[model samples]
Target: MAQNRDDDANDGSNGTSNRTSGIINSGRRGLMQGAGLGAALSLLGGVSGAGGLISTAQAAEAAFPQHKKWKIVFVNHVTTNPFFVPTQYGIQDACAMFGMDYQWTGSATSDAGEMVRAVNSAIAAKADAIAVPIVDPNAFDKPIQAALDAGIPVFAYNADAPRGKSNPRLAYIGQDLYLSGYQMGERIASLVDSGMVALFIATPGQLNIQPRLDGASDAIKKSGKKIDIQTVATGATVNEELSKIKSFYLGHQDLKGMFAVDAGSTQGVAQVMKESGLPSKGVHGGGFDLLPQTIQLIHEGFLDFTIDQQPYVQGFYTVMEAFVFLASGGLVGPANINTGLKFVTKDTVEPYLNTSTRYEGKTTKPQIVPMKGAIKS
Candidate 1:
């Protein structure tokens, strides 16, 4: 597994320039190896059984040349958040597969200034590529452009700049944040007829989540229901989010529903719902992410349904995109990827509660999970 480098003055460079000559040379070497083996195998009329399988695998490997262990820098808005544990695991798995390395560094408190500095650090380090969550619309534009100007491919993951806004990142790999929120809002409207409903957000204007909040509010407003939506700002940390959620519920005991746009606040919503026994009182609660506690609460009937944005794929696909761009020496164009959104209800939460795997950031041990039933779409 590749180790995650922290923010430090010493860049990970060991006398390597940002040149594609090494990659091209490696490709030529692989091509020679493939040509020699392919001609020999053809003369021998190929092998059979296990020998044939090994030969095929070797040929496939030869097709994709292995170059220098490229390093990609991932600048996140919340570096230590549990929601990204699986995301990091995805980064690790992808890096291992692609023979690459990555550094995970960013602000622990969603500080845009701090995140910008991290991006600057990565650019200065002469990283092979860079990925970041564009949490702040304008703050990342300059840094992304700078990275691109330095011959480093920059990608946006988890969050992207607002639509119609220009940002120089190559691609975005994450769920459709605004659409997911609108869909969740529709769910909320369906669950609650009319009353005061609270929506909590970790940060009010952050691009990563603010669109979700905006979408939810718009959906609720369009529902034409008498529901009163109150937007609450919960601090970045989990403990602070929990406290604020609890306090909100205490003051709005008569609220019809409670939901959140982010992971931590969603977990906090579930906790409050359970502690206050709000579900038994016909109060619906739900939010996003697959935090262990969130899954458990959903299974326990405390939360109606929590949305899954496939955080693991967000990291995995971003790395894959970066790898292709680097391996191709800028020939392969990276395209935007929507990770996807799925609502996890009580019926669908069983698997999540039963399994503890790196896919969900539950365990570090890697193993293929057995499937016993028909797959859900």
Candidate 2:
């Protein structure tokens, strides 16, 4: 039977659909149904829109056809990563909205080898599409190419290809890492000219973060900010990372600022700065993502600012983009989605802090104001 997803989308928005007979079954939390090679591809061409079927409120209401069902596997770096929670929400909601099948599985710990294995497993399982964060450029080349050779559509999200145009993945969906880093660096250089400042990375070799360190260095040099930059490799565990940073700060009491690239490390970096009692001094700090704790730290004046990459949007759009590629027999790569690198200071953090959704890991109700009484955002 040909299925329509519109009703489910409407129901999701208005909270009303009761029918369980359609292709748009929001009730089916998670299920994988094998699709014929070509049958699965048909659903990717959503109705009446160049953007995927879930592009608008109306389009999202339509369902994936029973005959057009496709399964996708999202192999994330951190399955339990609070940062990707919004992204997971995006993937789950988008699939539910489109009536597609998807499974998100990955290494709980961030390991390139585990991610590659997960992608290979999905390929062996014959998933229609595979989305992954190719954080390590060299490590992912073979696995990504293999997925493409096997007819599974591969996409890079959250992280990007450092060596651009080198990988065969279909598309990338995330912030322009280098540019965002450049912007952050420009700001840091504007604040202070000469001092020993450090840029920290959670995974040293990971391409996404390394570029930020590069951008900061370039920007600092360009600004003529004789800033002594230290590129520190902090392991992912938050407390342990925080302890290492604190030890560094204690030894280098004359340090100026510390900029962080990864999400988990931001909070740790903020903590170390706060305890150092250098708020009045030239100790300024900034980080990449807006983890809840990071936002709270900013609000409390323990940190300067953090970035907002809009992870949910990243997850949602990447899947939808891959779906578009599959269903339309078209291709979607080099897709530009904003991470909304919002610089949240004490003044700006509070507005975003009231979010009910556990942005790093949970679902949320859209905050909507009725047209009759609404003031525009």
* Model 1 superposed RMSD (Cα): 6.7
Error of 2 at 215 (Å): 0.8
Tell how far residue 10 is off in model 1, in angstroms. 24
Candidate 2 wrongly placed segments (more than 4 Å): 1-23, 26-67, 331-340, 358-377
Once model 2 is optimally superposed onto the true structure by TM-score, how far is the C-alpha of residue 242 displaced, in angstroms? 1.0
Each model's lDDT: 0.81, 0.69
Q: What's the lDDT of the predicted structure labeled candidate 2?
A: 0.69
Best by TM-score: 1
lDDT of 2 by residue, 1-377 (tens): 01121331222221111111244553332121134325534443654464442333334433333335567788877665556656766776667555566777766667888888888898888988888888876878898889888888888888878854488887788887887788889988987778898788877767767777777778888897588888887776666668778778888889889879888777778888777766678788988786667788788887888877788788778767776666556532335565656666787665567644524442344433233333323
Give candidate 1 misplaced runs (Cα > 4 Å): 1-62
Model 2 weakest 10-residue run by lDDT: 12-21
Instruction: Candidate 1: count the clashes.
Output: 0
lDDT of 1 by residue, 52-97 (tens): 4433323324445557778898888887677887787787666655
